[model samples]
Every structure is written in structure tokens, then in C-alpha cells.
Target: GESVGLHLPTLSVQEGDNSIINCAYSNSASDYFIWYKQESGKGPQFIIDIRSNMDKRQGQRVTVLLNKTVKHLSLQIAATQPGDSAVYFCAENSREGAQKLVFGQGTRLTINP
Candidate 1:
């Protein structure tokens, strides 16, 4: 089954720094990967994504590196700041009939002065 809790709260971080968020998935055959950043009371915005076929993909100040060899995924934020403060999430979609998505523990990013 997929991994996620009923009420797992997000994480927090400071401003002007790099942040590393980790995620653990249940399915070993997940084919697609996506990262989303959601603000207070807003929809999750797409940050970056990768596929099971490849290993790493980078964009803007954010970099997504996938380690399918161990079913692990990570997101790296460079020079994080006030605007970068938000909830970060990692999701994996299995290559099945329905192709459902599995979410992981969300991290709440907080910027500091």
C-alpha cells in the first residue's frame, strides 16, 4: 500500500538557505514522480518531476534526484527565502491500470530573517 498518515503535519525551515526534503514510497514500481509546493490555503504548484526510467532532473533553484535503486526520492532547494516558504510534497504514481498517486510526508518551509 501507499505511505501517508491521516494527519501528518508539515515541516518548517529558515530563510536564505538550502533545504533537503526526503520521501519514502511503498510501491517499488512507481513509474512517475512529481514535486509540489503549496502555500497557506493555496493549491500545490508543480516544482519539478522525474521518471522511473531516469535518475535525476533539475529546474530553476530546485533539483529533484531519484534513487530508484532504493526506492528513495529527494528534493533540494537552493538559497531558500521568504517566498520559498511553503509546504513541499513528493508523490509517486504507480504504472498500473488506474495509475493512482501516493503522497509522502509534507515538509513546511519557513523563511527567517
Candidate 2:
């Protein structure tokens, strides 16, 4: 079965510092990647996304990178803030098959004052 996992379970960054979260997916066939931010007691919210055809995509204060060669995906957040504290997840989807998205285990991002 295809699965996704985070390189680290948790990441800590000082306020105003940049933060990076990494995820590796087993599905080489994945064609789309999305980064989601999940706050406590709330559903995941879309942050950024990239397609296999592109190497990187940027959104407001955030970026998503895809490395198809390594089946790796990463999310970068600029200027970490208290509001950025949450669990981040990377999800992959392949258009070739049943149209399902596989989510990574998620990484807890802690923002320090």
C-alpha cells in the first residue's frame, strides 16, 4: 500500500524564523501534492500545493516543493508566528487511479515566542 510519512514528528522554530517540514511518500505514481495546516480541534486547511510537473509552488508566507525523483515533498513557512502553531500534513494524490489522497503522519510545528 502507498503511504506517506514525515521525516520528523515535531519541529520547533522561533517566532519570525523560517520553518520547513518534510514528508516522504511511497507512491511514485503520485502526481499532485498538497500541504495542509491543522489547528487543534479544527479540520485541516489548505496551505499550498504543487503538481508533479512543477518543482515548486508558493503561496502567501508558505511554499510547497515536490521532488519526484525522491518521492519527497516539503513545506516552508516564512516568519513563524504563534498563529502558525499547528500540525502540518502533506498529502499526495494520483490521477491515474481511484482518485484517493494519501496523507502523511503529520508534523507538529511549534512556534516559540
Candidate 3:
């Protein structure tokens, strides 16, 4: 199965600052995406997503962008907060019926005061 990976293992941002997390995927056929945020002792929660047809999508304080030409994906957080600290992951699926999603090796985001 194809895999997704992050360029960085961790990121730190000051409060009220914006942050960008990057991911690279091996599967060019992937057409669906789901960005997830995971905190300690909890399951991954969906943050935002962008389909292959769209280059970008925004939700609340978060934004997702896809570049199929480079097989890259990114998540932008508008404002960093203490509560925003978590491990972020990007999942990709080829959109085939019942296909499994490949998740990136999460990047830990830290919010600095």
C-alpha cells in the first residue's frame, strides 16, 4: 500500500501565530483526503479535508490544500493556541470502494506561550 509522510516530526508556534504542516504522499491516484488531530489519550479527530478536484478548502480556523502535481498536501492553522497542541496527520484514499486510508506519520504541533 502507498504511504503518506510528513517532512517534519514536530513544529512549534507561538500563541496567536499561524502554522503550516506539510505532507507527501506516494499514491498519485489518491483523490480523497482527511486531516486529523490527535491529542494525548484520545482518538484522532477530523480537522478538515480537500478533494483532488479542489485545490483548497477552508473550515473555521483551518485550511487544507492539495497539489496533485507534486502529490503534496498541507494544513494551515490560522491561530495557534494552547488547546491546538496535538499530533496532526493527513490521510489519503484512492476513493476506490472500501479502500483503506494511508495516514502520515503524524507531526506533533506545540503551541508556545
lDDT of candidates 1 onward, in order = 0.78, 0.91, 0.94
Per-prediction TM-score: 0.85, 0.95, 0.96
Better of 1 and 3 by lDDT: 3
Q: Considering only N, C-alpha and C atoms within 3 Å, which residue pairs clash in candidate 2?
A: none
Best by lDDT: 3
Write model 3 residue lDDT over 1-113, tens digit each, in one string: 59999999999999999999999999988999989999999999989988899999999999999999999999999988899999999999997789588999999999999
What lDDT tens digits, residue by residue, belong to model 1 across residues 1-113?
66732123554567767878877676776889889899989998989999988888889998888887767788889888788888888888876677576777688767776
How many pairs in model 1 have backbone atoms within 3 A of each other, for residues 3 or more apart or on separate chains, i.e. clashes?
3
Using lDDT, rank the candidates from best to worst: 3, 2, 1
lDDT over C-alpha atoms for residue 44 of model 1: 89
